[model samples]
Target: MPELPEVETTRVGISPHIQGQTLHQVVVRDARLRWPVPTDLAANVEGKPLRRVVRRGKYLLFEFDHGAIIGHLGMTGSMRIVNHEEPPAYHDHVDLVFSGVTLRYRDPRRFGCILWQENPVMAHVLLASLGPEPLSDEFDVAHLLRACKGKKQAIKSLIMDGKQVVGVGNIYANEALFMAGIHPHRQAGRISAERLDRLVVCCKQVLSAAIKQGGTTLRDFVDSEGKPGYFKQQLQVYGRAGQACVTCDQHLTESRLGQRSTVYCKRCQR
Candidate 1:
């Protein structure tokens, strides 16, 4: 799935083209996404000016005057800005047409969603319980330490929890833990406050770097320009299973945690 960085990159990439532009039309080729595309989406949003595009965790918000459209780029979904006259591809499931350009949503798996929200967006069911943004001041060391209290879940799982700290997905969690020298399976409450501080910093650093590099393109992720991310080249542990550890030259170990593949340098972590 497209994580925080990839979603943020898409938000940044499509903003300039659609912001302040009136929605000419909304074409939903398939309404059977993760959830049915809101039946009244086009009726409610067409002709309204799109105010801005923003990201919360892995969801993208297309803000307008009265409400917003929420989008999730599931395991293989992507958004791109293309010319208004461009033809839709086989996987192009939705298009938000504008005067001069079109914002296209393409997803092969149909696991993504495009929903409408008429209430306060933050209070919406999909977003109401989400944790603080990883790159924001709300995710400081003190906040993380407090959230970690009395929790026995693996530190990696804790960080990946959207309710604990949004947007620390599998890949970034591995990279951030490796950067902080924390083992992936360590109990959250057992970690020291000082180490938690380092982990917080590493999370922000890894996420910021990933966003700067256009996100990690493990498979289907791509920027609005349809370019793959470059951060995969900078990964230290996420997918380096059986590879020599860069720090100690020991073979990195791989395991399954929460059904997700985890790679770590045993000697370097813990």
Candidate 2:
């Protein structure tokens, strides 16, 4: 699935082309996505100018005059900008045609969603209750420490919780924990405030770096320009299960935490 960095990259990549352009049409080749595409999507958006594109968690918001369109790039979904006359690919499920270009949404798994929000988008069911954005000032160490209090869940699972801090997905979570030198299985409440502070900084560092590199492309994730991310090459432990640890030269270990693969260095991390 596309994480926060990938979603942010997509938002940045396509924003310039679509912003300020009026929606010419919305073509839905397949409405059976994670949720049914609204039957009146075109009627709702056509002729309205796209004000801006922003990302919250892993969802992309295309803002217009009266409301915004929310999109999620599910397991294998991606968005790209192309010429208006460009032929659609086999998996291109939706297209938002603009004046001179088309914003295409392609998904092989059909788990992505394209929905409309007529009210304050932040209060939408899918967005409500989400934690602060990881890169924002609201997600500092003080905030994380408060959220960890009285929680006995594994630190990995705690940080991955969308309600605790949004957009720390499996890949970034593993990398952040490794960078913070904190064991993934450590109890959240047991961690000292100082270490939690370090963890917060590491999360921001890892996520900011990932976004700078266009996001980690483990499988089908790509920016809105259809470009694969380069951050995978800099990974320290996420997928380096049996490889030697870069810091201590010890073999890294792997386990399943919350049904997600977690790789860590026993010597480097407590």
Candidate 3:
């Protein structure tokens, strides 16, 4: 699934081509996605101009004059810019054709979505209860500390909870915890405020850096331009189990927390 950074990368990549441009057409090859694509989606956006393409967590918010299109790259979906005359492929589920360009969506798993929502989409149910973006000022040590209070859940699980702070996916959760020197399985409530501060900082740093790095592309994730991200090459712990820790010079350990693989250095993280 595309995380926050990858979504942001898509937003930035496509924004240049579609922003302020009038839509010439919309083609829906398949309406069956994670949720059925709204049948009237094309009619709502076809003649209007795109105002912006923004991202909230893993969802893309495509703002237009009349309404907005909100989509999610569920697990194996991607958007790319193609010439208006280019032919659609087998997995090309949707296309927003403009005067000179086309924004194409391809999802092999049919797990993505194309939904039309009224303007001001932030208040939609899918977005209403989401926590602050990890790179935003709204998320901080105090925020995470308050959210973690009275919880015996694993620290990694706590951070991965979307209601606590959106977009800390499995990979980022491991990286942030390792950067903070916090064991992934530590009880949430048992973590001290001081350590929570470290965790908060690391979350912001890691997330911002990942966004700059265009996300870690170990598998299906790629930037909107169809290029793989290089951040995975810099990972210190997420997938480095059985490898030596760069900081403590000890072997890193691997475990499963909340059914997600976790990598950490036992000697460095307590």
Candidate 4:
């Protein structure tokens, strides 16, 4: 699935092309998605200028005059800007046509969504209970320490929880924890405040770095420009299990945490 940095990268790539441009048409080749595409989508959005574009968590918000359109790039879902005359390829499910270009949404698994929300888009059910954006000032050491209070959950899983901090997905979580030298299996409540503070900083740094590199593209993820991210080249732990640890020259270890792949260096992280 596209994580926060991936989504943010998409938002940045496509914003300049679509923001403030008048929507000339709406073409839904397939309404079957994670949720049914609203039948009245075109009526509500066609012919209006996209006022702004932004991201919250992993969702993209295309703001308009009266309401907004919310988009989710599920596992294998991607959006790209294509020429208006370009033919839709396989799995290209939806398109929002602007003056001379089309914003295309493709999802092979159909787990992504393009839905409508009223004026206060944040209040939408899909977004209402999400935690603070990982890159936002609202997400800080104090907040993470509070969430970690008295929780026996593995620190990795705790940070991955959407209600605790949005967008710290498996890849970034592993990288962040490795950067902070915190073992993934450590109990959240047992971690000292100082280490949690280090984790908070590392999370932000990892995410910011990923976004700068256009997100990590292990597979099926690309920026709106259809470009693969380069951050994977900088990853220290996530997919390098069984390989030498970048920091300590020790062998990295791989295991399962909450059924997701967890990789760490026993010598480097505790």
**Residue pair clashes in candidate 2:** none
How many pairs in model 2 have backbone atoms within 3 A of each other, for residues 3 or more apart or on separate chains, i.e. clashes?
Answer: 0
lDDT of 4 by residue, 209-261 (tens): 99999998888998898999999999999899899999899999999999999
TM-score against native, each model: 0.99, 0.99, 0.96, 0.98
Tens-place lDDT per residue, model 3, 89-176, is: 9999999998888999999999888898885677788888999988889898889889989999999998898988998998889999
What tens-digit string does per-residue lDDT give for candidate 1 at 1-270?
A: 789999999999999998999999999998889999998999999989999898889999999878899999999999999997789998999999999999999999999999999858887899999999999999988999899999999999999999989999999999999999999999999999999999999999999999999999888898999999999999999889999998999999999999999999989999
Per-residue lDDT value at 210 in model 2: 95
**What tens-digit string does per-residue lDDT give for candidate 2 at 1-270?**
789899998998999999999999999999999999999889999999999998889999999878899999999999999997889988999999998999999999999999999868788999999999999999988999899898899999999999999999999999999999999999999999999999999999999999999999898998888889999999999899999999999999999999999999999999
Instruction: Score residue 101 of candidate 2 by CA lDDT.
Output: 90
Q: Estimate the TM-score for candidate 4.
A: 0.98
Which ten-residue region of model 4 has the weakest summed lDDT? 118-127
How many angstroms is residue 128 displaced in model 4 relative to the true structure, after the best TM-score fit? 0.4
What is the alpha-carbon lDDT for the whole of candidate 4? Answer: 0.94
Q: Give the lDDT of residue 150 in candidate 2.
A: 88
Give candidate 4 regions above 4 Å deviation: none
Q: How does residue 138 of candidate 1 score in lDDT?
A: 96
Name the lDDT value of residue 133 in candidate 3.
88
